[model samples]
Target: MALVACLAVALPAHAVNQDDLLPAEKAFAAQVSRSGDKLQLTLDVAPGYYLYRDRIAISTTPADLAGKPVLPAAQEKADPYFGKQFIYHGKQSIVIPLAAGAPADFQLNVRLQGCAEAGVCYPPYTHKLKVSAAGGKTESKLDNWLGGAATAGKSPAGNSELAAKGWLTTLGTFLLAGLGMAFTACMYPLLPIVSSLIAGQGATLTRGRGFLLSLLYVQGLALTYTAVGVVAGLTGSLLTVWLQQPAVVLTASALMVVFALSMFDLFTIQLPNALQSRLAESSNQLSGGKALTVFLMGAMSALIVGPCVAPPLALALGYIGSTGDALLGGAALYAMALGLGLPLILIGTFGGHVLPRAGNWMKVVKSGFGVVMLGLAIWMATPFLPASLVMLLWAALLIGAAVFLGAFDTLSTASKPGARLGKALGLLLFLLGGAQLVGLLSGADNPRYPLKLIAASSAEGAASHPFQPISSIAELDAKLAEAKSAGKPLLLDFYADWCVACKEMESEVFPQPLVAAKMGQFVLLRADVTANSDAHQALLKRFGLFGPPGIILFGADGKEAQRVVGFTPAAAFASQLGQVAH
Candidate 1:
């Protein structure tokens, strides 16, 4: 019994599943395909396998192609043995720039290195191909990064998936994606965020002045996406990954709280009179034109809030990783950033004409934004706070706002239209807040659907049948094997308490009866990557994901059939499951 117990305990601590490890070639495969002047490097990487970004090298015989081969962005993985490394997964395309006056058939050599996420690595190997209109002669050479003969030349920096599509087309594509983000985020959901930021100016903002400040603000966002992105890409790390850290998140939240208090007029945010005058003179600033201040705020906010993951973002990341060209990558990302700011330009430049006359009304606006700032601060902190604490905070904010709006004030026929509207709005807020408070008492963790948990008996508002937990590659493999044996499809959800999107899926998507019924066709597994330990990082990197809130589906055949990143609403996820389950 002692021996058995000891073995059992030790097995989990150092578990390695050989069954999950694929043959090196099956794990990662590479080939070269040509399309007119555009020669392409196509890579088909199997699920649970990845190729190293630095490990993929290409050099043509006689001379380089038009330029370097372009591959997609890679996720940074910190290996116990190899430390920090960049890797890629899934079907990826690399644009091989075709040079002028190049022969139709030429010799092209490619080198690749890959590893199994199940605690194994394959030494680097090289392959040589003869380029032709029909097909090329293929030859293999076993080599490592240290082998100088076959492995030579660096992969050029360019966007992946969209590579060789022409620079103008690529930029245009990202610009359109940016416009989509603007309408979805900047135009609506983030209007208040931007409004509150500008309201802190305290003085009347003429349309021109508003345009200038807003333009500066958008430039700040551009600068961050360029500088921060370049650094993170070159280093094989992600800026969002760092910003999500507990210390950084808490600090940013605290700063927002201070900014909120400043807007409340409890304290001013200006420097000492003498110093302010001196600095103003030196900088040639107008009395109320705090251009530098707003610019810095814009930069800071971009860093704290972070951009959503999009295909263009992934391509830009790939560009940064594959090519070390900061200038071109910066330009491409800056274009996208401008696209993100496009809608804001209209709001700032034209929307200011409708502002209330600049006096007491301005003060009211500032105070209102103060409340918004406080809410924003709480939103930032929610990921790190306990579920109970987060619910309490939201309830407090909502109830407080409701009371200030005069929910309890009795209204009469003589009450003004504005007064009646205020009371009605206040009443709505009060009811919502009351429900949220009650939901908190009923053991609800989701603020979005607080009362839904009251119907749940065991866990309340959260996922009733929480995902079967898996922490490491070995455990994931074991679960996959178990599901395969039972002839069941599998759904592995990458989740973290810090991920608001994941919570949305858990509360809003998974709880739906239709979605739940569809999910029943598969074995449900959840990887709580909240701690982000080395093992957790390994599990995430296995599938080439940057962070949590990703879903991977495996058919009964045990091959990956579908992948959904970010939030997927119930109806959509249900439809997806129906297609895969059959």
Candidate 2:
């Protein structure tokens, strides 16, 4: 089997004889290979464990033989197991491509950790795998059987091949992890606490410490959420393997209904206040170390978040199960957890002291949490809920949450601190509202083939570059100028590192040899807006975009021809290209 590999740590990679020795053997490996003409690397994953994707640090050095490994086009594959990213399981692998003139021998130093089913996590391990290649070959085999060869086909890989690469490359996106961290850190609910920490707390949290803690907390939550997403992603992945698994889809649909209903508390089983208070007292009495307590928290929190996590979770699990990158699926969970917990932890650690001297704010926070819960409900119901009806219900739920929480009454009675805090929170909410509005406006206004004409030119003997992603109007003009002069059709792909749909296109549609061949016909140009380079930003501004993965075509005359936004299948894309190129 041609197992592409990347460099891992260099600890004693011998087979484990668990019965002997103080310093146990640490197993590690990396995968490196070529896709078409590009060299790439996929980090090998140990079974029943995973390595942190974010923790992976590329060396600034280049290989002597190939020069450097080009990073793959990163994209996001839908993961039902987790809402956000891919999770990996079993022997996860990343394809590392080598550039021309890379060294024959080189090392990749990696730091990673692994965990077990029983919740027994192993210590962090390190290793380096030696990589050597004689030239680009179709059949390349790399092997270093540490835990013996993985029981072939027993455990599914977390993500599909495309998902593996897409998830990594898409890191060029506005990092939801980062955005979530900022939002949670500065949420209105936490503002009072934050101000108190800054003013009165003996040991205040510095922005650096807070940011780092936010990162760790978010990472932890993301890991946890990724575990959930892995399950969901694997389910979505199976859609391909089994044609959307109707039974599974129906089950997910039913569960989503329940999630929505529960979030709105439509089927409340009210308990007496005395009983509720006793339960709360008991919960508080239990030490944090108690597994049962944690499990209970997870279960209760999940119930409230069912509407929020399930839709994404189910999709992620299906995706992961199908694609086979459970580690990324796992990582997705960590990312989600990070999103959910970072703010809370920061508030508790740094601003816990400053929370209003009165418990009144608790009610407000609870109400805010309730609103989020309802939002989750609507989101969960969306898969089964008719889009129109879903919107109506979502609006109703929002109104109901506000009214039921007596937000107006609180607003009326709010004192200076309370009013100021509310205003700040409202500002935060306004920002979120603006973001959603922008998404709505752009989504509704986007038209297919908005660019009426496209053109291109190319050099007589320039190495045929595959289709390039274009993010700016200027780049389009430049490529058009070149194509016009050279008399070649221009192929432009507008992409962002963060788009989930873009990822789907890459993982499922772009890699087919036939698709690759057709794509190579034109003078390829890529406009990547993931990092928001000045040029890409200009294009986004011109196009009125709040998000990514817009594909456009150009004719020999160097004018925009047709554009397709979001993920397009290989056949569809090819057909479109055929029309434009001709």
TM-score of each: 0.40, 0.30
Runs in model 1 with CA error above 4 Å? 1-242, 279-356, 457-582
Please report, as a residue range, the 10-residue window in candidate 2 with the lowest summed lDDT.
1-10
Q: Give a tens-digit lDDT track for model 1, residues 1-582.
A: 011111110001121334444444445555666677777776667655567778788888877765776665554443312333556656677888788877887867776766544323444445666677664423333332222332211232222323434558756755765554453322333455456556556567777877887888788877888785566446543443454358976886777677667656786554456854564353233222467765765565453335222323443454354333455466667777788787666677677444333354445555665676677677656666777787788888888888878899888889888778888888898888888889989887767668876654433323444579999999999998999999999999988754445655665677777787788888889988877667887886688665556789999988899887656667878888998898
Candidate 2: residue 395 lDDT (0-100): 42
TM-score of 2: 0.30
Best by TM-score: 1
Writing each residue's lDDT as its tens digit, candidate 2 over 86-200 gives 2344444444445555555455433444333211223333434444454332211222112233222224344244444565542322135323323321234234322322333
Residue-level error in angstroms, candidate 1, position 51: 12
Taking every candidate in turn, the Cα RMSD to the unseen true structure, in Å, is 16.3, 20.0
State the RMSD for candidate 1. Answer: 16.3
Off by over 4 Å in 2: 1-254, 264-324, 332-582
